[model samples]
Target: MELAKRIQPTMTRQEQEQRDRKAASNRQLTALLGKIAIYVVTTTLAIIFIAPWAWMVSASFQPIGDIFDWPPSWIPENFTLNNYTRFFEEANIGRLVLNSTLVAGSVVIAQLFLNSLAAYTFAKRRFPGRNLLFVIMLGALMIPGQVNLIPAYLILQHVPLAGGNDILGNGGHGWLDSYAGLIVPSLSSIYGIFLLRQYMKSIPDDLIDAAKIDGAGHFRIYWQIVLPLCGPALAAMSIFTFTYHWNDFFWPLILITSESLRTLQLGLALFVVRNRTVWDIVMAGSVIATLPILVIFLLFQRYFIRGISLTGMRG
Candidate 1:
């Protein structure tokens, strides 16, 4: 009886260990399955997002006939530059690219300068009604840009001393069909100012004070000290401004009348008009237009994220 009791306790101990091992094995399997499911779901989502761009890139190389194949080819069976060749031949693609680069480039440069300066002033300086002014500026963000289009158009149309407008701004078309019209109204970017302001506030005040102690003027301090420190913010703003302006269709469509002055977005519209649509050539143009933005984002992605992170932090 004593021997049997001792053997029974040993058996119970072994059973407990077996149960523990089995439970641990079951947990590991469950965890592995969960991880696999997560990876599969995320990978599927990635493919879904990437498919359109992949198709766009693939279709750009496809001949016009192959573009409409029943199953929709993800990879071109045979590649040809005919779509690209036709794009260049039929459209002023080079000129359109030039126009887009020029306009987007100019806006980026001007916005960097103007927005950084305004941001520095708002962040570091104390002036009368400063908070009120800033609040009003932020309030503008709540209003839809489309809502201000008419007012902006009227203002641009009636500007004095340029575009042949008299003192009353009631003569020739003020900046109409000109680069000035395209660029001027865009120069005062409240969003850019706000973005830069948040970033600049994070900069240490000691640096600005030290510069002031050296008898540096506000412009000198702003240019030499503050501006250089704002590289990441500037890059982020430049990319955003460039991308937005590059893809701007409505503003350019409304303002620009001459075909030669048309931006890339407007020029691409010539593909799908009245009765005809050229899918292959249109896809090629899309790829061309999209390539710059992708390249810019890839190059400056880190800086862009850093700038956004800095903006979220307090001074």
Candidate 2:
């Protein structure tokens, strides 16, 4: 009886400890399940978002006939560089790439400089109608881009003595069919200015004041004090600007009539005109067009993430 009683008490204590550990484990699992679910869901959505582009890349390696196989195959059974071969063979891919690079690069560089300057002015400098002007610019973002297209096209079309026009901008194509048209309209961006301005407001006033006390002029203060501090914002804006103009179809299409001047996206569209069923080459060109931007994104992703977070918080 004494042995039985001692053994029973020891067993009960062990069982109690086991129960407590299980309860604690269950609670942890329940909390962890919520986080795990979120991770799973977000990861799934990321994959879904990437699937089409992934498929496009995969199909680019496959033959034209195999693109629409019974089951969509990411890995091609018979891989060939024919699509890339045909891309170069059919289109002036080299010239198109050069044009796109020139256009996108110019836009990115110019927009960063001009917009940063304007944003700094808006954020730091005292000026008349500053707030009103900013509001107007914000409103511009709301307006459909197409709303101003006709007027912009008319201006380029009618500019004097440019393409072949007389003194009245009526002799020839003004900026139309030229690099000026492609770059000029895209250089100024209201959205970029706003993004930078919002991000700049987060910077403390003492920094600028300290610079001012150090005998820095407005421009110098801006260049030295503000620009370096806003690197993340600038990087993010550059990415957006580069990507937007790189993939721009409608504006470049309207401006560039020459195949030599056609951007990569425009040249790729020509493939659709030539053959709807020939998606392999189209996808090949797409992948080519996508690579630089993708690489750029990967490189600047950290800056982009920080910029976006800060801009969102302040704006």
Best by TM-score: 1
Q: What is the TM-score of each candidate against the true structure?
A: 0.90, 0.88
Model 2 Cα lDDT, one tens digit per residue, 62-112: 998899898898898899999999989888789989999999999999999
Candidate 1 per-residue lDDT over residues 1-315, each given as its tens digit? 346446667567667677668878999999999999999999999999999989999999998789899899888998988888888988889999999898888888888888888888899898998999999988888998789898888887888877789988989678777788888777758888888888788789999899999999889988999889888788878878888999999888888888888899888875557216688888888898888988988999897777667655532
Candidate 1 residue pairs that clash = none
The C-alpha stretches of model 2 lying farther than 4 A from their native spots are 1-18, 28-43, 313-315
- Model 2 Cα shift for residue 117 (angstroms): 1.1
Q: What is the lDDT of every predicted structure here? A: 0.85, 0.88
